[model samples]
Structure formats: C-alpha cells, structure tokens
Target: MSYVNQSQTLNVTSEQKYQGLLEKVLLSTLIAMPCCVFLFINGTMLFTLRSKSVFRGTSRYILLYNLLFSDTVLLALSQFLYTLAASKIMLSYPVCGVFTMLSILTDEISPLTLVVMSLERYVAVCYPLRHATIITIRNTGVAIIVVWAFSVLNVFIRVVLLLDFPFSDLESLQMTDVCSDIDMILSPMSDIYDKAYTGFVFLSAGVAVISSYIGVMIAARSASTDKASARKARNTLLLHLVQLGLSLSSTINNPLLLAISKTVSRVVFARMQNFLYVCFFILPRCLSSLIYGLRDQTIRPILVYYLCCRLTLSPQPKLRPKIHGVN
Candidate 1:
C-alpha cells in the first residue's frame, strides 16, 4: 500500500474501534448546565463589548468576538443534540446526518477559534509594531471567514460519506432510533484528510498563539523601559499561556488516551483515560468561565462593574419611619 492508503486504513480502523466511545461520551456532554451559563455570560460580554466603540475597533475586540461566537455556538449545538436525544425525538435520515455534521463542526470550531485568538495576541505582543499592519480589521474578518470556511469544507464530507454507507448496520438493538453510524459513514480517506487538516489548524493557529506569547515574555524580560506596562504584559501572557495549555493538552492528549485505553489490555489504563478526559475537557469547560472571569482584564472589569452596579443601588432605603403620628 502507498503511504496515503496506509494512513487511511489506520484512521478507519481507529475510528471504528473508537466509535462507541465517542458517541457515548458525546451524548453525555449535553447534561452540562455550565454550558448554558457560560454561553449566556459570554454572549452578554460580547454584546456589551461590541456596543462600546472601544471594543468594536480594537484587535482584542475582534478576538473576543470570535471566541465568544465559537463557544456559544458549540454550547447551543450540543444542547440541541442532547435535547433531541433526551426527548426521544426520531429524526429523519438527513436530519440525523446533519446533526452529526454540525456537532463536529461546532466542537472543532471552538478550539480553532481559540487558536486564532491566541495567535492574534501573540502577534500583537511579540511584533507590536507590525501587529497594526498584520491584524487589521479587514484581515481579522478574512481570518474568521477562513476558519468557518475550513470547518464547513471538512464537515461536509460527512454527508457524502454517510450517503455511501447505509445506517441500518450500526443501529443499536436497545435503541433503534439513535444513529450509531459514524465510522461506517466516514470515508476510508477521512482520517488522512482530517489529520492533515487538523494538524494545519493546530500548528497555524494553536502553535502560533503559544509562540507569540513566548516571544512577548522573552522581550519583556530585557526591556526596563516601563515596569508597570511590562508587568501587565507578562500577566496577560501568563493567563493566555494557561488557557492555551489547557486547550492544547485536551486536543492532543484526549485521542491518545482513548487509543491507549483501547490498545492496551489493562482495565486501569482505560479508567485512567476516563479520568484524564474529565480533567481535561469537562473541568476546563466548567472552569474557563471562572478563569476568564477573574484573570482576564477585559472580561473581569465588565463583570466587576456589573456586580457593583447591582450591589450599590441601595433599594430605596425601605421607608417605614413616618407612622409615629398614628401611634
């Protein structure tokens, strides 16, 4: 077999083996109430920021917009799927296929968008002078278009592949309506294609983001020009690093952990894989709100202002003191 053919075969085998695990976990992902809360907060922040001119024109605003859109869409899409499944809604063949396509698209897009945000910050901080020219509003718009276009292009393959394979084969005996036909529908070539595409997305967006922050930190070390500015830059970079680290660890390790749990005979390893996934994906999803809420200067201030405004109104001072004349 040629290299491409071998790669395709390996991916198909892996997909088939992992199909059960992915569906089981993906279905359970909908039960997360935190998803709704996070989406609401992020949506509100995006709206407020965009309403103000300061957020609309800045590069950070562009990144924030993309990030908020990505997460909100993912949560919404997940909830849709989970709700349908939970309510026992039987979807048509085409609808089921579309749901699967969208689920993957949204999930993938969230990480890819984060990658873009990271890269934007990296370029702005590391190449401060050039950032203005490189990350202009027009360019940021194009970059976002590229991210969506890429996701759509890749996800559409599912439709064609599913049409080629009948869903009847993968149906569970226990639940006939819920489709279990992911791998059977995926083209044999899907893995090679996806791996290449996912790798590009990770390196171009994810790695670039990390590298940018690293560059900024290194530059900040030697520049004694303004202590306060340098300190703030370092803190921002550190927070970005933390977010990136969490994301990268999940993207890279989750698959490997699953593969090991499958390939190895030991039951403990499989259990460990479950543990790591919760730590990586679930925990991060729940905690990212708190992380950004506290550490992100842009987001933190808005939240503080919102909270203070809520607390300071004093509720009209409760006027019950004028009844002494009647007594």
Candidate 2:
C-alpha cells in the first residue's frame, strides 16, 4: 500500500511537469506563428517592391519598404526572445543588452518611419505641385539613413549609461536566467530617464501622425479639383489612422498587462499576457502589411502576383508537341 501511494505521487508529479512543458511549447508556438507569417509576408513584399523599378523608385514605396524592413526585424527579435524563454534559455547581460538595444532601435525607427511617411502624404496632399520637389527619392533615402543613425546613437547612449551605473553585480548582469522582458537594475535617474524617453517618443510620434492625417483630410476636403482623387486620398488616410493606432498600442500594452496581472492567477495572467501580446503586437504587424498590400494600387498587383506564384497557381502556357522535321 505504501509503495503504491509513492508511485502514484511520483506519476502525478511527472505528469504535471509534462503538462507544464507542453503548455510552454504550445504558447511559444502560438506566439511564434504570427511573427513568422509577418516576416514572410513583409519579406516577400519587400522583394516584390524592390524587383520592379516602377515601385522601387517611388518615395512612398521607399518609405513603405523601410517600414516593412523594421517590422520584420522587430518580429524576428520577438520570435527569438519567445523561443528562448520557452526553451528555458537565459541570456547573459551583454547578450541581453544587445538584444534590448537592437529591439529598441527597431522599435524607435518604426514610428519615426511612420512619422516621415505621414508627413510625406501630408505634403503630397496639401501641396501637390511641390510634392515632387519636397519629397524626392534622394531626400527619402537620406531621411531613412538619418533615422537609423539617430536610433543607433540613442541606444548607444542608453547602453553606455546602463554600463556605467552598476546594475547589481557583474555576475548578475551576466546571468542568463531571466524573463522575456529582461530585468536590468538601473539607477533611479536612469529609470526615470528611460521612462521619460519612452513616453516622449511615443507621444511625439502619435501627435505627428494624428496631426499629419488631420492636415491631409482638411486639404482633401477643401480641394476643388479631382473629387474622386480626394476621396481616395481620404480613404488612404483612414487606413493609415488604423495602422497608426495599432502601432501605438505597443506603448500602452505593458501597463494594461500589469493592471490585469494583479487581478489574475499566475497561470491565468501568463495566458492573458500571451494572448494580448499576440493580438496587440504580433497581429498588428501582419495587419499593417496586409492593409498596405491591399490598398496601395502600385503594390496590390505585385502582391497578388507574388501570392499566386507562392500558391503555384499562376497560369502556365500549355505545352505543344512539335512535329518532327516540320520546320
């Protein structure tokens, strides 16, 4: 009787552990699928856009391409982190710092790119005659380069400060056993600075996008010529508004998660957070690309062609047997 009870207890424990591992794997897979899909779709879109000279040379497409590139990198990073967490792999401080830096760099650049894109649209709609002069391909390229440089420099400064301030012991920093959101010990000032910087960037981008769209709507409304064109422009702006809202939600997601976490059990909280992450972060990344691919006249055909080719359903010419010696 004693032996049977011990065996039963051992089996139950083993089963619970197995269930936990299964849950982790399933959650990780769930988190990863959307990121993979986003990367594939955006990557194909990037290739298709770049392949055609007509699309490649346009300023709007250039901005869109950069946005896609940033999103792909961001999603790739998220996938990496989630996979690591699921596998119980911890990263050292330096590795974690690098991951954090690159993540921040991409995240910052995404909104900045959107801001530039919105401004580009605003200029095109409000001042159609001078749009070409104001937003040239060369200028767009330069702007993208500048945005990257700024992001890199911003991250570098934060990293330097983080290193300078001893966040626990060096051993702690190098320890790999941590959560997906790496918990780094920062000084009080550093913490404040980080929060302020994040808020400012988020707010600034949000305001710029909203204001640009408003300007575009007003310009479209007042324009006397090309009513149809103006209406189309308004529709495009509305789509952008949706995309912008989705992008900005990342900034707010953390707080919301924290609020909900307090009210839930550990397992429930984890599930809720995972659900939120997929819905808010991963889903939006794909939806943004879908919106652009579906709505943009220049990109729509190429996207459709790419999808058809991917499906192996593109029309093929029927083969004919040539008569021997007919020629």
Q: Model 1, range 238-306, lDDT digits (tens) per residue?
A: 666666566555555536765776777754674564455456554554454556556666667766566
- List pairs with backbone clashes in candidate 1: none
Q: In model 1, where do residues sit more than 4 Å from their true spots? A: 1-30, 83-92, 166-185, 224-231, 248-289, 304-327
lDDT by residue for model 2 (240-286), tens:
66777777677667678879878989888878877887876687677
The Cα local distance difference test for each model comes to 0.62, 0.77
Summed over model 1, clashes come to: 0
Candidate 1, lDDT over the whole model:
0.62
lDDT (Cα) of model 2: 0.77
Tell me the TM-score of each prediction against the true structure.
Answer: 0.66, 0.89
